[model samples]
Target: MSPSVAFGTDIDERTKAAEQSSTDVLTAPDVPWNLVIWNDPVNLMSYVSYVFQSYFGYSESKAHKLMMEVHKKGRSIVAHGSKEQVEQHAVAMHGFGLWATVEKAASGNETPGKGGRQRG
Candidate 1:
């Protein structure tokens, strides 16, 4: 014995629409991402600044400024780039023992420092 299922007249159209929407979601354009460093009790402030300098090639003053932002504000978006680029930065930050994360840049928000400065 088998049960039969009925299909609605709009089933094909609905399926096509769903497929298209899924495709759109899958192929969505990549947006700029931010590499945010979060303050933590584990890492020293000097070490954090060093990571910013050595990793991102930021000047001593600029690195110290960003480091202070993290120390005072609890987090700071230190770099901005394509999703892949920021993700790679996040991984490198982790390797340096810094708490870091990547997130989509908020529309209209100013990114810290010169935006999209590629790591040297």
Candidate 2:
């Protein structure tokens, strides 16, 4: 039998390569973005909370807390993820009649394009 087959060298080498590849993938950094929801007079608190629950799948308590934060603070960071994801969330909030925007969480700066839209 070949030395590789007799001693499981092939399996060992494959395992080492797999571990290295997984480690490289796991260590890669990702830039984050934040979806900020602004309080608006047009949306009721319950409706805002409902939107949070429905869109984000957050529990009632979590949605209510975030909604209250928006109410009291004028704005709240409702979600965080990749720029595309946060932007999508902001757009969904817009569809719900809530003022929302997405900003780069890494630099704490707003991204370009429709990220800064507000209800007129």
lDDT top scorer: 1
lDDT digits (tens) for residues 69-100 of candidate 2: 88997888766656655665566577668999
Error of 1 at 52 (Å): 0.6
How far out, in Å, is residue 50 in model 1? 0.6
Q: How many pairs of residues collide in each model?
A: 0, 0
State the lDDT of candidate 1 residue by residue for 1-120, as single tens digits. Answer: 111113347645534443333233223364467778998888999999887765555667778888998999899988766676667667667767789999888875756645323222
TM-score (all chains, Cα) for each model: 0.68, 0.63
lDDT of each: 0.65, 0.60
Supply the global lDDT for candidate 2.
0.60
Off by over 4 Å in 1: 1-31, 114-120
Relative to the unseen true structure, what is the C-alpha lDDT of residue 22 in candidate 1, on a scale of 0 to 100? 25
Candidate 1, RMSD to the unseen true structure: 16.7
